[model samples]
Target: MDIFSNHKRLFLLVILLFGTLTVFVAIFPALNNQYSYEPLPDSIPLTEIEQRGKMVYIGNGCVACHTQQVRNVEIDKVWGSRPNVAADYAGIERTNFWVNTATLMGTERTGPDLTNIGKRQPSEDWHLTHLYQPRAVVENSVMAPYPWLFELKDSIKITEKDKIVNLPARYIKDKSKKVVATEDAIALVAYLKSLQQVKLPDGTPSPEFLYKREQKKHGANESGGSSALDGAELYTNYCASCHQTDGKGVSGAFPPLDGSAIVQGIDPTSMVNIIMYGYNAREEYGEMPAIGQINDLSLEELVALMNHERTSWSNDAPEVSLEEINKILEELKKQNENQ
Candidate 1:
């Protein structure tokens, strides 16, 4: 008993417990700073159907595959809006939700990012068909069909003779004797419609509007001596390899010249500047090599080429002049020297 009493095991155990508690208290705030719970909108409120669908989204583990955040580089390179900011989530009231706490913020993207999914494809019927069978629309999509999200009813009698309605497939019974969407698919569609991309900044011109104006101007000069046909041929030889024949581009590698506001905008000066001097290294996509160094095209040739690209395919930018090109080149030289 006297030998045991001389030991100090209790003192050592107390010191260890205190040290562990102290460390945890110090680090807890930093660890929990990643996610913030916010309330949804009240004006265009989420309906009971949408709420049920959200529950299904969580239960099905959709977040395991998709991420919502878009970084700054991602926005510029992918033609997406600016990176997500905390102000975007400022209005939501705090409440307990089924959040993925392991990553604190969210998981890595396994599929296409869903941040602006609602805006990307805005058709409800398209989403319904895609959910029922993805291969029906996107040939390369890997997402599994979520048939269980739909309410299944068999032999629903056709009511209106004039209306052509597609019926859901026959329902299958589970071990519990419950009928489900041949896979239960509609709930997931509701959830997808709720996920909208963030709004763009004010004063940003839509590609469609810009293209229409370009077309109107081009149509006016159709009977004139202008020749976009020659421009088109030149583009095929010089530009098609990097910009692609369609003009949509290779995503993150080549910036889309077609439907680009800068290409179709009122300023022909900017267009000449970009073509003559090449873009600076600060561009989101890698710097375009200085093709102007080749010195192959004369002033008129460059004008024809620019007109062809701006008005080719669905583009409609106004025709540029040789005078405009010379002015832009002079300005570009000055800017280069200043750099």
Candidate 2:
């Protein structure tokens, strides 16, 4: 009760109080995150270019549309094999001496999740085309095109490496100007290629989506029959977003699948190749990503998707067999090797 008598005692108590608060604020997060640490296999540190690309991605507001965190929910099967864990991002390099801005785990997902994008969509060509003109690849994509990242197309002095994007014909502003990729584009692609989740630690079981898989098995058509569930279901799951339910894709964005000549063509090889390899046939239409290949669809599933597209919209093409699809895929592989 004597105010002046305990001044020294009071000063000591204040120091202790502030010191404990500082420790709680700074040290607890590191300790709390420690328990979640598990070494994932096949993990690699980011390179200098990849780090620069990360900054580009951050600067461009990619986190606004796409999320880096994969939820534990059953509906998140399309994103990755497992929900995001702390160790998946354990290898993220520190920006400065005391800063690590790699964890952007955004909540909003206007676009598809990017947690395992490097695994799901690893092709640099695809990203380049998509980045130059999002609508060029993804019909109805509201994403802004980064044309500054590329040069106009011109045949005189450009190699395949310099001209990575094979844009659809309709979007070309000037035919003389061949689009060449800039360093920022390469950096951005490298950064995106690094955004993958490594496998979970040992003893931690992988997330099994088979439970929800069957429940979400699509394809209850007007002309329903006992056909394979994997194809129709996979088509809806993987391709339906861009191509649409009726297959009459958005105008000026995605090409028509309902009664397309490509769909109804005699040789299934071309269509099959397109599904597996991707296309930039017309500049007007958006580019098609290699849906079958990227999604790892089986021969039977690719056949199923082809058949379903053919039969639907009153455009009946002959049913494609797995044998035929396999042949087409093999031939294409050889051609790629030859080239």
lDDT of each: 0.54, 0.74
- For model 2, residues 9-79, the per-residue Cα lDDT tens digits are 78888889898988898788777776667447768888999988988888888888898887777778778
TM-score of 2: 0.69
Predicted candidate 1 versus true structure: per-residue lDDT over 4-50, tens digit per residue: 46557666767888888877875665345434533223224445575
Candidate 1 lDDT score at position 75: 30
Task: Give the runs in model 1 whose Cα sits over 4 Å from its true position.
Answer: 1-45, 75-80, 90-105, 151-184, 198-339
TM-score of 1: 0.42
Give candidate 2 regions above 4 Å deviation: 1-18, 25-36, 96-99, 119-123, 153-161, 168-170, 197-203, 208-233, 236-294, 313-315, 321-339
Best by TM-score: 2
Candidate achieving the largest lDDT: 2
* lDDT (C-alpha) at residue 49 in model 1: 71
